[model samples]
Target: MNDHITTPITPDLLRGALELERTEHGLAPHRLPVRARAQGDGQLAMAEAQPSGVRVVFRTRAGVVELDTLRTRVGYRGMPLRPDGVYDLLVDGELVAQASTTGGKVLLLDMATGTAETRPGPVGTVRFDGLADRVKDVEIWLPHTEITELVALRTDAPVEAVPAGERRVWLHHGSSISHGSNAASPSTTWAALAAARGGVDLVNLGFGGSAMLDPFTARAMRDTPADLISVKIGINLVNADVMRLRAFGPAVHGFLDTIRDGHPTTPLLVVSPILCPIHEDTPGPGAVDMEDGSMRFRATGDPAERAAGKLTLTVIRTELARIVAQRSVDDPNLTYLDGLDLYGDADHADLPLPDRLHPDAATHRRIAERFAEAVFSPEGAFAPQPVTA
Candidate 1:
């Protein structure tokens, strides 16, 4: 192997991705393309395009692989520092190394003042030294929770993009629950875990604080190539109180319609949100209460609001079941898995959502396991097809 060889970080070397757009630093992998981005709020756009489940896949005989990246870290004033995002390295499909950037810019926020500031930090390089001497496939999974810009790549040997996974691509979209919120690592996100067990390539479009049934997101899904698809809806909508029930059904139909436009026969799974005690019956617009010097979420909407078409997790589940059942009459590929099946009140009673909303890492594991068993079984709607020799 050569002592040094710099490879431009280009789009061709990545997989489980939708689009790669040039950022000021280098390439920013995006789940949503320009068209979808142009139509979303700055928050939604940023979250949706943050490269969850995106990774760089290449083949080489390199002994050392170094990746330079600029990560934008989020911080809250007076709170415990958030850990650096992890970059997982897999060789021949087995995880061999895990890394994190040493330094990057930080976005600081003061929840009390409603003010935010940026602290400039330097770009950092992550090096994974010592690999097998023979040529092999390598995949560097980017940090799922950080906003990262791929600046450059260096290896000891010549490299080329590896072939895409032989397994079908599974495209899934949801809110923070699916975005790896509080996940142990990018590859440990529930969807990631399920994808691994289900033996499918994952394209995670789980946008934290987003996933509001946006037309652009649906359109993006409609245009993307995929063999199987799923959308985990409800949590973000209810928490954000983005829409009333009167508008939700039509919005859902519209979103599914857009996906059907392109994936006329692809098996589509519509997942409702996992059980959150706070939002189970209480209509949302969830509020973060820091009045007691603790950051905890509280259900702000009154249960009475449901009388006027407001949304709650229970309401969403019922509606989603109805919608999927009605459509399955003609579209047999459509399936609905009650989010409760993956996680319900009983599970939560034992697991307990630490934040009263998002699932902890252990809970993420439970959800992933349930999802794999329920959806990837031979009788399941998204059962894996046997590979032909």
Candidate 2:
């Protein structure tokens, strides 16, 4: 007789998502809650649904596990089809296996016209067998760059949700770089790697082109329960050319103020953008360089615009340092980290950004190492505080 058990995907078995949307095929994890999604654009929609740090967590003695999923893959019309998203399986906190689905829905975009088309496909199954039979922790990390709908999970033995034992929860918000851009897999993203090193549960809200200090996003961050919080700012603002320097400061202030409304004493760190040579002194309205039929980015805004309060990486960094310094006077838990400290000129020279924008896989690992050492170490900003009488 067959003894396999099939389990339905539920919130109890999932981590990192603020909300889950029920879909025809299965449940879709979302980094942002419904209210925040309602206020966002298409970019935010795609990014949030990618499930950067989201994963399925459970404990079981089964050696055989099967997961059914429907993945939504993104593609560009002229560019070669992107590779299928990767799903990583970790047993007892160690990466055990990696797999990719064969076919699923595909969303093709026309970059020049800003139009997109979606083609339907069927669900795919990812199976992992030959794991040790002893009871162990299991984490099935979803694809960080694809929209995944969880269908069902099958195991040779019963599975139970893992309890949130002693791990501190880390809530991070930023741009695409933090959204696992160019990272090898879900567990390899800089934020994920850093969270692993810190021994914290991660919640990543790194929208691709939509980290524009949206009020609703700040409110979402305010309402979320977290032991540690961080916001990586500057890049998206500059690339999108959404605001001037005059507006950027107040927007950042308001974002932090909103988060403080809920967790006034939580260790909150604000990080500026990492080094981007093209946008260092040049203002953005960054443009795609498609003349050679390859993806590259160049800043289009005039460097002279800085005199008119236009935002650049250098200017933003200075302003962020000033704001954090002034605010740290009243809020001791508030800390500022220069993005360059994570990925700076010297490091960039060694590992240049693949597209003059996002970091490649190796750079992601480097950034994660720097972040873990600087922010997760005992002396770091988010380090555990000693209790006093």
The candidate that achieves the highest TM-score relative to the unseen native structure = 2
Could you give candidate 2's per-residue lDDT for residues 112-168 as a string of tens digits? 899999999999999899999899999999999899999989999999999874589
Clashes of 1: 0
**Candidate 2 has what TM-score?**
0.97
Give the best candidate by lDDT.
2
| Clashes per candidate, residues 3 or more apart or on different chains | 0, 0
Model 2 residue 237 lDDT score: 89
For each candidate, give its TM-score against the true structure. 0.95, 0.97
Per residue, candidate 1 scores C-alpha lDDT tens digits across 44-109 of: 765865678999889999999999998888777988657888999999888899988888888787
